[model samples]
Target chain A: MATFHFELVSPEKLLFSGEVDAVVAPGAEGVFTVLKDHAPVMTVLKPGVVEIDAAGNKEKLFVRGGFADVGLGGFTILAEYAIPVAELDAAKLDADIKNASEDVADAKGDEARRIAAEKLAQLQELKTALAL
Target chain B: MPSLKDLRNRISSVKATQKITKAMQMVAAAKLRRAQAAAEAARPYAERIEKVLANLAGGVSTGAPVLLSGNGRDETHLLVVATAERGLCGAFNSSIVRLAREHIQRLQGQGKTVKILCVGKKGYDQLRRNYEKNIIELVELRGVRQIGFDQGDAIGRKVIDLFERGEFDVATLFFSRFKSVIQQFPTALQLIPAQISANENEAAAGGALATYEYEPGQDEILATLLPRNISVQIFRALLENAASEQGARMSAMDNATRNAGDMIKKQTTLYNRSRQAIITKELIEIISGAEAL
Candidate 1:
């Protein structure tokens, strides 16, 4: 398998930068994967997991609210919040889902309600995917 | 002319002050190390985002987002002044405020209405004396132990909401840029209608020059990215300000400690001289009384 450079960046610091075989990211439209020599593309990211396969080892990280860009420089993900799945706390996830549900119920405007609902859905989806 | 008791008190007070200043200097030095590391770590993300923005901005020539292109009016100005929450940092807060003052004066001179958005308690305290009416909001981070992206995001959201409401025609952010431990530069960056550096565009374009396919569309990506860019810029400013604050405080406390030491030494010398003079006078008196007897 061919490899390309991949970088995962957060506001506080750069999390990961290395040559990777494949990166599967959750895009706003849908989930997509990037491989070596992939065409240049830019997409917004939602709350979900980012799976990285590098040199036969696999890593999964949860990201929320950011963008992914694949260019001549390779692939880069600017995540608003990112943490390894292994380090995630199940109790915190449940609390977040509960809060998000309340926000959805209390939202007044149509746009606000829609955004809150979307957030709730994403959190629920993540909970099921992680099975925690 | 003073008593030995007074001299002793003065010397002791000076020595106590020196101890405090020395402790502060050490604390500042330790904090500066961590702050500098954080500022350096955040650089790559900022640079990468800028590059990505440059690429996207260069591709879109017409129908650009309102954030990339202004509202076509420059009558009103919003200044976002960011300063350290605490004082005792030599001239760090004052310099930023001074720069902001000059900007306000210049804008008012142009027959333009100016609004102030102060980010720290120090800045708000200084600016409110004269421009109290002009200040729209004061965002205090006094309770925060460390600056994070969420703080910046909150400020950015407020600015965007104001812009959307037609509160100001232009928005500028003021902060102290950390060059080194000994040097910090006060800088002003235009936030609304984002300023994309010319060199960045050339550098980004030089690399790929390949057209990018936007997932949804160019407009949608830009609409989201530009807003995020604002938050990123604010986060960078806050981090730089943190490093600069620690640097300034360290140097200031170092000077204070040295001055206190000098004062203590002078007071000790005065005390010794006074005590010796008193002893010599008493011995002379006793000798004179013996001769008379």
Candidate 2:
């Protein structure tokens, strides 16, 4: 059986790197999976869940926006913010979402509003994943 | 002549100073170790990412994205100055700010419009006195709960926002690259145009080019990839700064401790000589009085 090496990294740290039979990432458009010898694909990752199937085990990660490169050896996901599902504190994340959402609504100017909105969107994605 | 109490007071002050500096050196040394570790750990990941990006970029055409395209005008320039959040890292912050100042002066002489964005508080505080008008943003991470991607993303978003608005033709990031505890170099890099080429032939470990497939197409991917690269690079700078700062602080405090020790030695020597001279005078007076009696 062939195994693909899957690695996820952020600027601060390397979140995960392991050999997996398959992996799925939420891309800019939608979710896509990569298997051994799957065609090399590169795309932007959206704020969503990334599920990795390694050695008959499944692991899920919540990532903020980033880039993913699926190449000859394996797949690499470069995320701005990548946290394991197990690490996600649902209560805290919910509070974060609520705060972020309120900040967006109360933002005075367009620039502040956009940044606030983006934060809200990312937190909301985490909320969805943790709720599941 | 100084009183014994004064001498004692001076001795205690010097001793206190020595203790403080010695303790600071020790603390800085520990932090420096952790900082160096973090910096070193980031290298492999950074190198791999750069390699992958470089390969993909090499395959893509020059006219693919604005980041890759580089508008062909160096008229307006944006300089992102990243420095340490705290002071006392001997010349670490000043050296970077100095380099940025020189760059700004040179650009101004050429009649180029320049804007500045400061990442750490120290840089902003230092440069703002002169470049207040040019400062577009100031992001201080001193109060940050943690150092992570979210901070980088926030900074990256600002840089991208400015770029998309066409505020500058080129953007440069100034930072100190950590080499060792005693050595750090201020680096000025072009962030815009995504000119940084990642490590070459790194992806070859997996075998041949192997025909890459684009999901949302290469062009769309590049558009986003280029922007994200800027933030990643900025984040890298912050981490490097964090490490370099600790290294600088450790070395600086070590030197300070040594200097303080030398100063205390010289003062003590002076005090001892003066006390000996006074004792000799008093002994002479007592001998002369006994002869008269």
Candidate 3:
């Protein structure tokens, strides 16, 4: 079996770094997985869950938005916000959803409203996904 | 002449101050380690973003992105001065403020209108003295334990919004760059109408020959990358300021402790000498009295 390096970095700290069996990221277009010898690719990520499998152990994380870089060396996701699935609290998510909705309602123009709505939609999707 | 009681009180007060400064120094030392590590850890992201920017720099048409090409004038300027929230850090805040003051003066001399956006309370307090009217916004991180990207992003968004509104044609960020525990120098970085240094451009051009490709057209990526770059720059500044603040506080407190030690030694010697003088005077008076009897 072959392993590839993976790193998930947020603004506050480096979240995860190790040799992983595979990494599945929620890219803007779709969910994509990376393995050993994966082609170099760079893409922006959407708000969703990222699944990582290493040595028969599975870990999942919720990411707000960010970019993923797949290079010859390894794979890295520069996440805007990332939290482990286990640590995700419903109360905080609810607060975030309320804030996003307020942002949408309080937006001054079309551009601002659209951006806020997108954020709200993402939060809603995350909530629905978590319910399952 | 002062009473012995007064001298003793002053000595005790100085000792109390010394203890406070000593504790602060230790706390600053611990915070410095974490701040320094965070600043160092963020370097890779900064570099990566820069490389991507360099790659896409050539593709963007001149004056396409307002961030990259400016709003066609440099008459109005915005100085984003970042400093520590607290004041025990010796000259750290003052140095950054001084640099910004000079820069503002130069711009004003050139007949440019300058607006100030203070990121920290200390900077706001200092700049408010002279340029109070010119200050547009004050973003204080007083209660925040650690500087995060969200704060940086908010600041960046505010700057961008101001620029979009034609409030300022040029924006410069002022902060203290952390070099070491005892060394931090104030640096001014141009933010609006982002300028790429000659060296960075050359290195980026060299790296362009590599097999990296941008998904979608290069212009599309650059459009989004430029604004995100602003946030990254602001985040870097905040982190650097955090480290510099801790470093400055640590050294400043260290000096305070040492000065208190010196003062204590001098006061103790003076007190002992005065007591000895009083004792000699009393003994001589008693002997003279006995002879008269």
Candidate 4:
């Protein structure tokens, strides 16, 4: 299998940087997979799992509120927040869900309420997806 | 002449201060390592974003987002000053505040309305003396053990909200750029109407001939990216400031420890001399008393 450089970076630190066979990222539009020699594209990312395949060793990371830029250099994910799926804290997720629900209740206008409700849904989806 | 006890007490006090300074220096050194690593780790993301932004900005000349294209008037200016939450990092906070002060003075001189947004406790405290009325908000990261993306995002969101509300036409972020352990350069970055250097655009253009296919259209991507870019820039600045703070503190504490050592040496020398003089005087008195007897 051909490999390409894949880097997952958060504001705090670079989570992963190495050669990977493929990267499956959740784009704002939808989930997409990138392979070697992928076209240069820029897309925003939503809160979802990013799966990486390197020599049949698969790894998953959770990312939120960031973007990915695929250039000639490599495929890079600049995530606002990223953590290994194995290391996701259940307590923090629960707290976030609770706060998001409250935000939905407290939101004033239709636009704000819709955004909050969407965030709440996303968190809930993430929770169930992770089965936590 | 001072008594022996007084000299001993003074020497002991100096020694205690020296111990404290030494401990602080060591702690700062350890923290500096972690901070430096964090700052280094964030550089790749910042650099990549800059490159991508430059490319995106190059492609879109007209109808660029307000973040890339100005709101058309520079009547109001916003200064976001980021400093250390705690003082004692030698001139770190003051230097940043000084840069901000100069900026405010310049902007005010231009007959522009200037508003301040302080991101740290020390900056707010220092600028509050004169610019109290101009300070719109203070975001204090007091108890945060480590500066994170969330803190930067909060500040970025606030700035964006203010921009959306037409609070300020121009925004500049003031922070200390960490150069080395002993060198930190106070820098001001214009956030609003984001500045992309010409050379960067040229370089990005020259390097990649491949036309990027922006998902969900170019304007949509720019709208999302420009805002995220603000947050990323603020995040980088915060990380740099954190490293600079630790570096400044390490060097300052090192100097303090050295100064305290010098003081302890001088005090010990004076203390010994005083003790010797006192003992010698007593011996002479006893000898004279014996001779008189």
Candidate 5:
């Protein structure tokens, strides 16, 4: 059997570690996938869900943007934030998103506003992904 | 000399304290595991960034990026001191700040201007008393429950802005690097002007070393790289600090608990000896009274 060494880690802890068939990541430019023989790459990740496939079993994870290192032997996904679907607290996350939205609205200047908005968007994306 | 009741109460309180310290030690041990993992996980990204910079910085002129430019000017310096938000970690935060204070004293003695950016509450709180005027900024982590890239990006952006404004020529960061439950070292590193000594590059794990290419020009890539590097460095420092704080606290609490147990044992032995002496005296007095009768 062929399997690619896979790991998904967040700052708090390693969320998942096992051999998986493939993985899909949200890159700065767009969505990217990694197979066993994928070329090496270094890029900034975007907030999205990472899908893992193993023996026809699938699992999804909600992640915030960070960086990913892909090589021939294996791939490691390092997201600024990562949480499994089973672990996501919807109500708490919703409240957080709402507060961030308000913060974005109250931001004073362009820079502050952009940072706040981006944060809100990231939280929103996380919530939406969790809903799935 | 305290009374027996006082001694008994003190023993019970010591026992209670031992229980608390033992519990805290267990909690810190558990948290240290997560913190250590986070710190170790950050190495690859940091190494990759350095590899890219090394490849791009290959014989590149010092004037290419302001970050790599060291005009041998030692007039002004920026010190970024990172510590934990809270305390009670066996002087982990103070150790880093103490090193920074020594650096600042030497820098001041040399007649160099100094600016400081404190990343955690503990550092700012401790350093502000003596160097408040020199503290340019404080990035408080009270609002953040966890460390992440967004915070890193924010800190990175702030540092880059300061550099762009010519606030300081050299930037240094002070932190504690985590190793195990009982050991850690206070690390002082130069952040700005990217001091990647050849020795450090050699020490980096070789298996992960690979050549990296910048799609854009080297200088342009460095413009982004240098700033991001600051934040990434801060992020790593924070992770390491977290682990180190937990490790130190764990060991400190374990020692405290053991000391408390030792105290309780000594007190109990004294109490038993005194009681035995009193019983012996009473028995002797009773036998003498019978003889007198």
Candidate 6:
């Protein structure tokens, strides 16, 4: 199978970069997979696992909200937070959920409250995924 | 004239100072390497965001998003000044503060309400001497080993909140742009009323803009993207400042070490001369006493 270039970049570091067989991203509306020669599309990412299948090896990473761009040249993921599923810290994730809930409670307006709620929901989902 | 003993003490003190400075230089050099790597690593993401932004911008009408179009008033200005938490980094902190001060003066002179938001301790310390009332908040990242996106996101959210609440009409961020170890200069970026420069336009035009499609329409994506752009820009600035701070410290320590070496050399010369003069006088006294006997 012909492979194309793909890079997964986070603020902390570049997590993955190489030719991949297929890349699956947890998009806002649904989960989608991209392969070589895919049409260019920009999509928002949700807080979930991004699975990358490179040759025979499979890698899954937990990512916070960010964006994925499938361009003609290659596919790129610009994530706010990206870490291996195994490296996810349960205690810190719990603390983040607590803080986000507080933000929701202290939120002043509808928009702020909605945003905070969305963040809280995402953290809760992550917590559930980890079974923490 | 002072005795040779004093010059000896002075030389020893200078040597000690030189050792300290040399050590600091080495430390800064090591730190600068890490900081530079971090800053460089972040560039691709920042550039990619801008590219995506430019592509989306082409579809939307100008002045549509609140972040992109802005609130359309320049009456109130908030300056987010970023500097180093610690000092001894040459003019790194002072230069940022100086630029911010001048900007503040210019804004205030125009009868505009100017507010200061300081990000680092050194900047707050300098600006407080003159513009204490103008300062709104002082954010100190004192013990943070590495600058993170969370910090940038918080600051960006604060600026957006202030804008949404009608607290400020315009916002500007000040930080040092790191070029090299010997070269770093101050740059002020306007955060609020995000302006798309010509370079960004070209970058998007050169990319695969024609092929990409937005999932939920252009305007909707822009609404969320613009706010994230602010956070990304601030994150880049913080990283640049980190690199610049270390670079400045390295150079400053290097100069101090050289200056200490120079002072030691001058003191050693003086000490030797003084010792030789004292010995000659003693010999003359002994010869005179022998002649008189």
The candidate maximizing TM-score is 1
Q: Which model, 2 or 6, shows the larger lDDT?
A: 6
Docking class of 6: medium
Error of 1 at B88 (Å): 0.9
Tell how far residue B182 is off in model 1, in angstroms: 2.1
**Model 2, residue pairs in steric clash:** A40-B213
lDDT per residue for candidate 1 within B1-293, as digits (tens), equals 87899889888888888899899999999999999998998998999889888888877789998898999999999999999999999999999999999999999999999999999999999999999999999999999988888899889988988998899989999999999878999999999989996755695657663568898887888898998899999999999999999999999999999999888888888888888999999999999999999
Report lDDT (Cα) of residue B4, candidate 4: 72
TM-score of chain B of 3: 0.95
Question: What is the TM-score of candidate 3?
Answer: 0.92
Overall lDDT per candidate, in order of appearance: 0.91, 0.81, 0.86, 0.88, 0.77, 0.88
Q: Against the true structure, what is each candidate's TM-score?
A: 0.95, 0.86, 0.92, 0.93, 0.73, 0.94
Per-residue CA lDDT of candidate 4, range B53-103, in tens?
888877776888898898999999999999998888999999999999998
Q: List-wise, what DockQ does each model earn?
A: 0.85, 0.53, 0.41, 0.74, 0.17, 0.67
Model 1 TM-score, 2 decimals: 0.95
Clashing pairs in 3: none
Give the alpha carbon lDDT tens digit for every residue of B1-293 in model 2. Answer: 78766877898798899899889889889887877777666665676667666766766655667787687888999999999888888999999999999999999999999999999999999999999999988888999633565677678878888887889989999999999889999999898877754443454444455477676777777666777678778878877888888889888888888988998898898788888888999999999999999
Residues B35-133, candidate 3, lDDT per residue (tens digit)?
Answer: 998898887777767755665575455646878888888799999999999999989999999999999999999999999999999999999999999
TM-score of chain A of each: 0.90, 0.75, 0.90, 0.87, 0.75, 0.89
Top DockQ hit: 1
Which is the winner by DockQ between candidate 1 and candidate 5? 1
Candidate 1 achieves a global lDDT of 0.91
lDDT of 4 by residue, A53-120 (tens): 99999999988657888877789998878988888878878987898899899876898798789778
DockQ, computed on Cα atoms, for candidate 1: 0.85
| lDDT head-to-head 2 vs 3, winner | 3
Model 4 gets an lDDT of: 0.88
